[model samples]
Every structure is written in structure tokens, then in C-alpha cells.
Target: MQKILGLFLFGIVLLTNIEAKDYEIKMLDMDKKGHTMVFDPPFLQIQPGDTITFIPTHKSHFAQSKVIPDGAEHFLSPLDQKTTFQLNQEGVYLYVCPPHQMMNMVGIIQVGKAVNMQEIRSALPKLERKAMTNKGRFLEYAKQIQE
Candidate 1:
């Protein structure tokens, strides 16, 4: 009876577990929207514990974390390589493609909630300072966040 009860409890645990979701962002030379050196779906909203896979559909573009909530780790994937990021922090994340950031090749990710949006807001000017063109795109993406 004890062994049977343990097995039953294990089954219950498994059944109640919430599985993390997965998402993908493609690195493209140019998207249908006419943005160049950009990540497809440049704006994303995900719950905590979700995973984002950045796929380099075109060579020479990579994803690198630019700004994140305090204590969140920064990441940089090799150029033209695929990388996956497991986001457990409940805040905003800003990522960019180094070579093309000047072209406004950037992305925004809001995890769970924009907990640190205020902090990110303060840094937006610096982030956009590198964009030779399309600097206003940052504000455009920022506004997309409902919070």
C-alpha cells in the first residue's frame, strides 16, 4: 500500500507540473516588414520560465543581450549561430545584433511583466545612441509593451 501511494503521488506531481513554453526568433537580413538586419518578431512577450531560441536564418547576424533586469545574466551568441535563452527573470530584455545595431537591429522582450521597465526606460537613450538610423524604432518597440 505504501509503494502504491508513493507512485500515485508521483503521478499527481507530474500531472500538476507546469511545463515551460518555447518560442523562436529568426535572425534575418531583411524581413517582410522591410526591416534589415533584424530579428523576426522583434517584440515578444513571454511568461517567466519560457525559452526563446534565436535562430540565425541568415549568416553574419547574432543575438546578444544588451539590457536586462538587474541580476539577470547577459548573453552573446556567436555570429551566424543559433542560441537559446531560458528567461526566468520577470522583467524586460533588450537584445541587438552588433554589426547591424546601427541599422536599428534590435529586439524587445517582456518577460512575465515589465518589472524593470523603469530601469530599462532610463537606458533607452544610451541604447539608441548607437543607431545611426532607425533610432526611433526603439521607442516604437517600447510602446508595444502593454505595461
Candidate 2:
């Protein structure tokens, strides 16, 4: 009986330690009704083990990583219906759609901490004009994480 109780408690602890979720980021057309030429939400805060599924609600849209945490892996979605990526690092991740990049279809994900903030800031200016517009927003989000 004691052994069985111990096993049950171990199972419960294992379940409690699994902290992962699937976040959705939709991609819309530039002419969409509600939101267009952008990633829905545009910004997200998640834990290190979280995953983000990028869904192209419209045609010709794909999510590609522009900047990621220093030791994190970069990702690029195929020009398909959806793409999912798991973030295992603790930092900021920036992504955009290739074809609609000029329209500023971009997004940022904050995982755990904004550790690579300086790199993200330095890389912002090199982005397109439309993407630069999001710099302030991203910086603001980063500040919140720092605090």
C-alpha cells in the first residue's frame, strides 16, 4: 500500500511540473476586415517550454524568425496552412512574414525574460520601415518583462 501511494504521488508531481501550452498567432491578409497585414495579438508572453502555432488565416503567409534568443533555435514556417514552434529559451523572439514584411506584419514573443533585449534593439533599425514602427511597442513590452 505504501509503495502504491508513493507511485501515485510521484505521478501527481510529474503532472504538476509539466508547464507547457499551445499559443496561436493568426496571419491575416492586408485587406482583411478586422485585422490585416499583422499577426494577431502581435505580442505574447510565455514560459520557456511553451509552443506557438502560427496559422495563416489568409493566403501567401508564412512566419519566419528574424531575431531570437542568443542560444535559441530559429524557425521558418512553410507556406502552408500552419506552423508550430516550441520556444525552449528564455528571451525575446521576433518574427515576420516574408512576403508581407514591407507591410509590417510582425510579432514578438517574450519567454521567461528579456535577456537578449540589446540584440533585439540593435536589430530593429535594420528592419523595414513598417517593422520599425513596432520597435516602440516591443521595447515597451520588454520593459514590462524586466520589471
Among these predictions, the greatest lDDT belongs to: 1
- Residue-level lDDT of model 1, residues 72-91, one tens digit each, is 88878888778888888889
Off by over 4 Å in 1: 1-18
lDDT (CA) for every model shown?
A: 0.87, 0.78
Judged by lDDT against the true structure, how good is candidate 1? Answer: 0.87
- Per-residue lDDT of candidate 2, residues 1-147 (tens digit): 999999999998787568688899888774345545778767899988889999878789889898999889999999956888999999988888888777677778889878987888787656645553334444444444552
Ten contiguous residues minimizing lDDT sum, candidate 2: 132-141
Tell me the TM-score of model 1. Answer: 0.88
Each prediction's TM-score versus the true structure: 0.88, 0.79
Model 2 error, position 55 (Å):
0.9
Clashes of each: 0, 0
